[model samples]
Every structure is written in structure tokens, then in C-alpha cells.
Target: METNEILRNQIFEIIKNQLKHNNPPETKITLDRLRAQGFNDSQARQMIGQCISVEIYQIMKTNEPYNNARYIENLQKLPKEPFE
Candidate 1:
């Protein structure tokens, strides 16, 4: 697979795992909230993936550990887009 496709698949797998395990629980909740607000499963998941990307970027750029709080905050702001 191409590099971008590989990364997207990796992110997709992370999302599937998050939903499967409900590690943060917020992930599933965010999925439901987005659905209720009229986003389809794919759209909602893509939005969630964007949040994950932001978290990943922060981790790589700052060399800090994952921040669940920031991730959750980004999720709560859905469709508005995640900047952090």
C-alpha cells in the first residue's frame, strides 16, 4: 500500500480497536453523538480520526505522551473541526 493509505488503515484500525475496547469510552460516545447530529458512520469515524491525527501530531511535535483530555475535548467539538 502507499504510505498515506497505510497510515489511513493504521488509523482505521486504531479506531476499530477503540470502539471494540471502549478504552476512552468517549470515543464511542463521540461516535454516537455525531450520528445523532446527522453524521453517518463513515463521516463520524473520519471526524474522530481527525481528532486522533491531532493527538498524534501533538505527540510527535512536542514529544509528549497522548493527552486523553485534549482528545475528548476535540471530540466534543465535532464538525467544528479539531485544531489541537
Candidate 2:
């Protein structure tokens, strides 16, 4: 797979593993954790930002009740240009 695709998959796996442990859906992963798992600083940051984006999307597209705090926090953490 391409490098970007591989990175995306790794981020997804990290998010899945975090969720699998029964962490609240709004729990945010820390950059240190991702870095300890072998991701470089930039990659770790990107992954965490992506995770926040996904969580926000899920809350919006589903019947789940909106969490004002989590929504605001995730939005604040989101990269300025998420699609870049």
C-alpha cells in the first residue's frame, strides 16, 4: 500500500484499539502515547487529529446525543486544513 494509506490504516488501528479497551467515545488519545508506539511526532499529531475528526463525524451522523464539551474540544483540536 502507499505510504499515506499505510499511515491511515495505522491510525485507524490505534483508534480501534483505544476504543476496544472500553474507553469513553470522547476519550482523546495523547501524542505521547502514539509516539511511544513508534509514530514520529508529526504522524502522532496527525493521527490524534484524525481521531478527533472521526469522533465528531460519528456524533453528527448518528442518533447519538451531542456532547457539547467533546464537540468543542474536538473542533478546537482539529487541524486547520483537515483535508490537506
Leading candidate by lDDT: 1
Clash list (residue pairs), candidate 2:
none
Model 1 lDDT per residue over 1-84, tens place: 899999888898999999999988999999999999999999999999999999999999999999999999998999889998
Candidate 2's residue-wise lDDT over 1-84, tens digit each? 899787567756655665577354443445555566686877755656574556556777885764656543653444433331
* Model 1 ranges off by over 4 Å: none
Worst 10 residues of 2 by lDDT: 75-84
**The candidate that achieves the highest TM-score relative to the unseen native structure:** 1
List the candidates' TM-scores in order.
0.96, 0.38
As a whole number from 0 to 100, the lDDT of residue 79 in candidate 1 is 83
